[model samples]
Target chain A: MRVVLVAGTTATAKIPEISAAGADPTLVGHTPSADAEIIEYGDTVRSPVTPVSPTGCPTPAAITRAVRELTGFDVLTVDAGLAKPTAAPTIDVGARPGRDIREPEPVPTAPGAFEAARRMGLALPEDELVIGETVPGGTTTALAVFRALGETFPVSSSLPSNPTSLKEDVVAEALESAGLSPGDAAHKPKLATRYVGDPVLPVVAGLTVGALESGSDVTLGGGTQLLAASALARHAGAAGDLTLATTSYLADDVPELESAAAELDVDLVVTDPGFETTPLDRYAAGEAKEGAGMGGALMLADRMGVVDDVEAATLDVLSRLDPQAVDGVEDGP
Target chain B: MRVVLVAGTTATAKIPEISAAGADPTLVGHTPSADAEIIEYGDTVRSPVTPVSPTGCPTPAAITRAVRELTGFDVLTVDAGLAKPTAAPTIDVGARPGRDIREPEPVPTAPGAFEAARRMGLALPEDELVIGETVPGGTTTALAVFRALGETFPVSSSLPSNPTSLKEDVVAEALESAGLSPGDAAHKPKLATRYVGDPVLPVVAGLTVGALESGSDVTLGGGTQLLAASALARHAGAAGDLTLATTSYLADDVPELESAAAELDVDLVVTDPGFETTPLDRYAAGEAKEGAGMGGALMLADRMGVVDDVEAATLDVLSRLDPQAVDGVEDGP
Candidate 1:
């Protein structure tokens, strides 16, 4: 399947990993990927502009512009933006003894991009569209988004190889300060984003919704990217044919993602070798529960046959972006 | 005050982060840190003996031995070992699913290390004894240790920048699989460690017990090191002047560390600026917490200070072993 990698931040880093993986991929960024097709977005901004703090958000307009610049496929962006009235208020009550709060606003950017694609009458060459994002602090935002969506998962407690506990604390505090208590699923996703989230959510949610509405197959890339896909499925009221692609580590944790798939009552395909456990086994073992659309999208990709290595596949996708490097391609306008 | 940095892992990929930090810090691995002291812990044994998988345990003995060799400090290893025990076969069984299970048992090595230190009549130094560790997949182990210690915090749900979710999932599954659900204060830490833990637990527990018995001030460095310190405080049933010197991130996310401090009633001090919010705020807000014993230990030397911009105070400490490097005064062995 041809993959169009949508980057939110640090687009360059993902390129080499994708291009080296031997996939037909294109780079949608202001700068050209060294080895892949380069589709320059007019809204290429610096990383610090939207500082990737635990609560910092990415610019949706940039994502929309990037997608518009890259492809002619019909896009559907989900409108998940809600005014973050809680931002100033939460920071006001510094360390006050209280529970955290979150809002449920759909992400704003992805929907806009999708809508623009639809307006342009873009048609997918195939039945499936692989969707992804590049938001800094996305994991923290994913935790908040899951919580905001009424999923009872501990979103911010793991200390992976990186020891950025302070960032996690900042996110947790921001959530708590906003009154989104740990187990309270009453808040909407938009409010949570405003209170303690980034911009990847709405965009991914929009893509999922648009793809489902169009009856097209979609592949969600990365763990946070899958979370966005799950949120979109939940909103669309149907899972459709969505594929969740990411590293093995994510498929192991966050049972809520699986639970969300189950709730959606759809097929699930996980494109990572690490997620070999059966869906039922995951749930029975308390490893994970099929989420809203678990069955439809939760399938594991056998690396041995499909690709030599997932990392290599990602790198290969990155390498395909440079028109100058393509052996048989004509020069672009 | 003097700091002793221990460089255990000799991976070429990992060294530059330390060397560029510009501390002129001492290098303790086979190769030396640039322009500092060099104590070689040759590649006698490969670290992270296991492949980097989604769910795996760290080799704590490797780290402990490296630290012991680098510092010449008395070693206190955990006294537990793991061998796959057959499950009692009695119930109706179907196809046994393909599952990855790791058992970590604490094995305390060299009781003489503790006894020897005591026999030496070693008095507590002006600066507390700071201990750090380098163990791959330590975060997974840290979560297990935290859960084992009866901390109800989500053992693994948050994302820590790294793409691996297996560590997070393993911790979550261990808590649920062991049936040690959260919200029970009566839970025993040892029981949890036996099921889903690594060797670091008991050794850390031993260190806390040893330090309290000796009545000395101590500082636990690194993320996993702090987790070990927390385990020590929780299981040892002793509390005195113990300070946790960890990255700002742990001080923020792992609620158990703070809870352990409160439970042990010890002070918490994070050293990294990027991971620390309050410490960073304190530095920024001009309310720096300065204790007589808390100032930089390695800052006194010309080679000390921000080595390569990342904290090399630990490296500075490692450099001190070569007495000639400091003031040209050679101290005989």
Candidate 2:
């Protein structure tokens, strides 16, 4: 499967007055979630992290690691916009992190991003494209995009407990500050993204359009952020079949996502990694359920007939990585 | 050989008052020869070109084509800084093209470039690295870098006829403008690149240093531009063995290159494509003799025991691409 992993950041994450309710407090504090994911993706087991939880949570990079080990597919990371530099070889789309949704025009690189994505599409190999994303504070922007598209969907959050109320309040405040209501989103799909969305939204929409034009099946990966991309693609008159894939956690958490996908004419594909059976506490707790292309990667592994193999591989990796568990057992005796 | 091909542009190329006597007038007119080289390297024939000459001249990309076709090695193109977007998947270093050499700082990205290159190094495969570059007006900047390193070597030019005098004049004016003379270039190598060089130089130096530190044998590719990199790598106290490789065209054209290599303690390897045997007018005319990692690609192909195969493949490609030559024979019948 051809994969396009888009990464970006929202300065909304840095809003001092905004709720510290989106991403994991630890990763978001040190670096943008995109950078943290990328760093983990590159150096799988021993990546640097400031663990807020006593036992560090399993990074979604585990899924990427599984895909690499089982299928040997390279993950192409796209920097739609980011505040920090990625260690991976990233495709820079000339974008910057969106500062405040209240500013009205947040993603300044929206038009250029669309063109870059279209150009990227013209270069991809002939295969169904699995497009995914990793962006902190994406859900709020996704909510804005959804409302603009007239979908009253409850978006999922990176946090274990969905911060739906907090996200709604922030989006509401941003729209009011920008002098835009949900109805103003009418025909201008791009306008919503420019006013309230993160840098990755318009660019991913462009990628979807470009891939569809190239006659490739497209999969919008991740949760509400991808749903936002689906809405933009539909409004852009995308012709090819489009599917939205996510983790069971995101699908199960975001209550209205099913109807939103139906309204956008996107087929839904959800992967159940059965992290419930795993020894990893984070996946069980739903702390970092899906981002950095984890859901799509799992789906691709399943298609490659190595879903079981990938799961085992991920377990082996995480087992080796969690020093506290190994040390505790060794020292106890 | 694992190859890292770095490409960039200098605004110095667009200086109307500056002699258009550096790069091939034909290829540089249409595209950054670097981008053109990347396209040709990816696809051996039928790559885009604007035919300024009735039959286009042979590009250094021919060397890259020969190596890839013969040895099946991968080419990694690094966008240190570029004026135009490349069709290939480039590792962007987040650099802007130099505005003017007369400005105190020509390449503002030098410090950041060094860091980026080092990071790139950390990510590269643990293998011998073949580092090559393609930058328009690179030789003049090479002269500047060399001068900053306190070397008085006359650099090579891409023009069929070497415009050493004009380049010397330009370098002199630039050095004077930057308020720097040869002696001030002592221990700080990055200083020279910042004052007068283009964006690609420092990054390549960092790549060289990183590869060396990784215990990989490194080969600096192309002509004077690489010599400048060698100077930086040396000053940076590079530990690994380095060999500067280029075409006989560059080695023969530049008088002081041999001594410069000796001073920098880099072993020099030169390849002869033997264009004299071919009926192609441009090859015989010696236009665009070396750049785009051509000479190093040739060396790698030779090491793979396919130099003759690559030469034959190149002739076949050039013959198929040159329309007038094909048309002349077809019309004669």
Candidate 3:
């Protein structure tokens, strides 16, 4: 079965605009909770609100739900850490939501969560594994982690504007607060996560390492955060058939993505999602680029030879959410 | 894959001698933690202490370790509730450790845990599920749950001299404290768990019911707790090929067990465990009567035709724990 880790970080709360995974800043805390429910139950019945962009772009869980309906590739949500716990059934990795990265120790649960998630990865029952994440503001953590390890690539953003200056300011203050210099933790990948990274970084990294070591073909799903995980696994000496998969939306936005994949020495596959005259056309227009494993779920649909059905299935899922919302989409001539 | 749920309760501390699942009352809270670790890692590597009786009879996790070593049947621990959490990798069912049943509401987490576990059950990926639980002082809670639900089966205890009267007094007072009488929750099994039962009860019940409804063959393992789960499932209108599997150790003590199985309309399978001339022969002497899914693991080992190898494995595992302790057992000859 494939796994998507739903997590939270106070970084989203600190810079609410840094993430649009939820409808609002306060709901950002519940995005992981709502995303977990969508992955598990195909609806947000357990959560008080749905995970949608402030402007109403569907959470990637809608695409994930479409994949579940079509391909039947087993999927489960692993709760790495969350400020607000999900009402969906999830595999807990012994973590709690981390504080904003400016704190001395942003993720105190790092070591234990890494170890726990590693064991979880080692015991994965499937021949193929897709490790994904749904942490809002995770790319900011990825950027900080990359800086800590002395990587120079700029990470992509969920928002249209890259928000590079703001992310850089956040990461700069964080690195300074944690008394860390670039390349100081190049040899100790775990140290980066303990200091300035969010909880999802170490967890996704551990799962990738363990699953790869167990000889399962693993795909790290999502964009910059997954790149961060692959880099961590690479530095930690975990080796196997590993792939970092994400959407062209990210690749289109971040010019350095291909070179970053090359520097990590891992296979990287970029997907287009192929939505036509649908609400998801926003993906290509640089709105809500990727989160909640959308890129990986789309790739799986392609592999299962059911890619043609995903867009329709996604629209159907969105219609179920609110018919008027789907009806509100404009049809281009 | 077989699943064992490890949980904790405040009930064990309320009347210390009422349980011997741990080495002492203080260790009782850690029993589930230790048991979960033992099952996951084949030793108490993640736990601060081992799960042993007050006099040092091993926890049933030893036998489970033997089964894991011998039969190669997959085993995983699901955490239902733990006052002190285990460091071992576990599936969380979203419940917290419950209070002593004498309180107004012993298990406030019951409803959510039940719903979460039922979702867990329905999503079960394995074909044959052996659902077991390890909760210290569970028998007393089982007695209260059964009384509240109008069942009259006497439960088994870990100690050689069953603390029957103490259990009865505790249950009687708990029933009264909750403003409930006998049969008060006959049709509301969930209510019994909320008011007087432990967290493990509702979780196990939900797993059994959801697994059963999903058409996965399920065997409820352990003594009275499994029976209580089956009874709850039956009363809740969940039906499928279901069996309550326990050890002859429990059958040897509780005479009404067969009648209870008959009343629940579920097939009952009792195994001998066959530990003759081995350290585990203490099982026959009734030291620790069927817990940590020992009966279910034994039954699986027997089904896999590795029952003969299990005895030697148990000895090996025990010797590894402490060679001196294994040598202390007297030779039967």
Best by lDDT: 3
TM-score of each: 0.29, 0.77, 0.66
- Tell me the tens digit of each residue's lDDT in model 1 across B210-241: 55566656665444435444554555465566
Q: How big is the positional error of residue A137 in model 2, measured in Å on the Cα after superposition?
A: 2.0
lDDT of 2 by residue, A1-333 (tens): 556778777777665423222324445532333333332343421124422222345456656656766775545667777665554445666777876676667887877887778766655644688888766677788888777767676677666666677778778877877678786776566777877888888888988888888888888867788888888888777767889888888777776778888887889888887766555445546556676677788888878888777667766544544454333222321
Instruction: Give the count of colliding residue pairs in each prediction.
Output: 119, 0, 0
Model 3 chain A lowest lDDT segment of ten: A324-333
lDDT for each residue of candidate 1 in A26-114, tens digit (9 for 90 to 100): 32222211101121212111111211111111122222222232332222211122111110000010011111222332233333443
**Model 1 chain A, TM-score vs. native:** 0.49
lDDT of 2: 0.68
Q: How accurate is candidate 1 locally (lDDT)?
A: 0.33
> After superposition on all CA atoms, what RMSD does each candidate show versus the true structure?
26.0, 5.7, 7.5
lDDT of 3 by residue, A155-215 (tens): 8877767778888988998899999998888957789998989888888888888888888
Write down the worst ten-residue block by lDDT for model 1 chain A. A85-94
Kindly indicate the candidate among 1 and 3 with the higher TM-score: 3
Cα error of candidate 3 at position B53, Å? 1.3
Q: DockQ of all candidates, in order? A: 0.01, 0.18, 0.10
Poorest 10 consecutive residues of model 2 chain A by lDDT?
A: A44-53
